[model samples]
Target: MTGHHLAVGAVLRRGKDILLISDPPDWALPGGSVEPGEPLLTKVTQETGFTSVLPERLLWVARYPAAGVEYEMLGFEVTGVGPHDGSGSWVPLPEAVDRLGRMWFAPIRDPAVAYLTGRARVATLWTWTDLNEAPVTHPHVAPA
Candidate 1:
């Protein structure tokens, strides 16, 4: 669909800390929209300044609707993080979960937690509904 936007995010870790960028009152992953024909690793490196990264797996795929567009966000488990250029903070996993749970796209919180905690067996599919209050999750939503 023309109204759909594709984004890629990395679950970058340093021991027990996860990388998160400040999105004003909320925090988000260190990645951005993926351009056609561009490598996913390139986007992660550009946003996070991690020149050396190894993508472990795809963690989650979420369809989040905002303002009339649907964002198809793909989260990946990336390892081998080298030096960072001070772009984002390395927060503890628990703290990062708390911060992400309160973000605008709150639906991402649970899936991210599941993956980080070694509870996820496969990449999850999520549908997010914004009810003007807080976003809610509908897991394994069927594709249209």
Candidate 2:
């Protein structure tokens, strides 16, 4: 893990539906890399086309290594957005969880499910290996 970058993601929710983007065969959250002096909300809105965004809370932090780069990914629970521009799919929470589970990114799946299901009271940390086939290791759970 020689290279490092900071990224931010949003778990956009409208009622029970979660906003997901189809990047080829995988489903992903609507977010991108956070630049210096740029707000997380601004980055999320730019990626998702949601004009009004209210970041509810920081849900999770993931240390994922891929392609020889270590990524510090942050997931936030966001709300108060209007209709999207059809750049992504709005699926029900259950289906969203199922889709996320099948993808290689366990960081997005675990925290989203935990927070939405009322299981996660505080932000959790997840560490993932570089290999796509390898499973996540040492998942951190917040104390009750």
Candidate 3:
């Protein structure tokens, strides 16, 4: 079993809806695990393919009741959109399940998503951050 976990997510707001994953067995806001020492910017871009990916601070933390996992998650707000190199289009929160298949591990819902989404419910996209050697808080990642 896994112990404490850490990750970064977006409190993404496109119009009124926030990005989320609805696929069952596990549902959540679109986010992923943060490997030690990785820059949040590169991770989100690789996971969500949102060329506009920028890392930010605060947002909030999350604690799951099921496995009792706690994570200090960073949240970014995507401000623009661009073509995905060879991947796919950015999916809306509602269509997450139909568009992308479910993730392998448990999907985490960051407190930031719900807070920003203004709903008690939110879903997430699955991904894992690469190893990080650089400290977090890049000039492009800090809250603006």
Candidate 4:
């Protein structure tokens, strides 16, 4: 059986902008893996240093292969968050596509813009063969 890397991320929004974590030159959502008996939202807060409300529904699911391992990233629509301490900052929605250029992974960035801006209605799925290649988007994909 092939090993799989499963992770959950929150698309925290503030008005016309969204939250992004600066992980040493890389930008991404505030989230992490699902520990045994531990919730996804809890992991998000721990990793990103931001408090977030439970998402109303799943937003997206992305899959890609790298170094012989299959990676799966789940995205959720976090309704809100508590005060942040500058660890991570917010970026405008309209400018996110340009600002996130090469600074973050596409799987996370694309869905965040789509969902936050109301382009998608439900959980989507994405897959790609190469990290540099564009991902195939399937919006509102049903859960497996």
Provide TM-scores for the models. 0.76, 0.76, 0.47, 0.74
lDDT of 2 by residue, 26-93 (tens): 88788878876888667778767777678888878878787888888888888747876766889999
Instruction: Tell me how far the alpha carbon of residue 56 in candidate 2 is from the true structure, in angstroms, after superposition.
Output: 0.6
Give lDDT tens digits, candidate 3, residues 13-102: 566444554446554445577776866655556655567665433454343323444444545565435754533334465554433334
Candidate RMSDs in order:
4.5, 3.7, 10.9, 4.4
lDDT (10s digit) by residue, model 4, range 1-144: 378878888877678777777666677777877765777678777755656566767888888887888888888877656765565678887565455544566666666656655666677778887989877777543221
Model 2 residue 1 lDDT?
58
Off by over 4 Å in 3: 1-5, 21-24, 63-70, 85-113, 117-144
Model 1 over residues 20-127: C-alpha lDDT tens digits? 988788888877888778776677787787766788988888777787887888888887467778778999998997788777554465567666665554577766
Ranking 2 against 4 by lDDT, winner: 2
Q: Give the Cα error of residue 92 in candidate 3, in Å.
A: 7.3
C-alpha lDDT of residue 86 in model 4: 62
RMSD of 1: 4.5
How many clashes (backbone N, Cα, C below 3 Å) per candidate?
A: 0, 0, 11, 0
On lDDT, the stronger of 1 and 4 is 1
- List residue ranges in candidate 4 displaced over 4 A: 48-52, 81-87, 116-121, 140-144
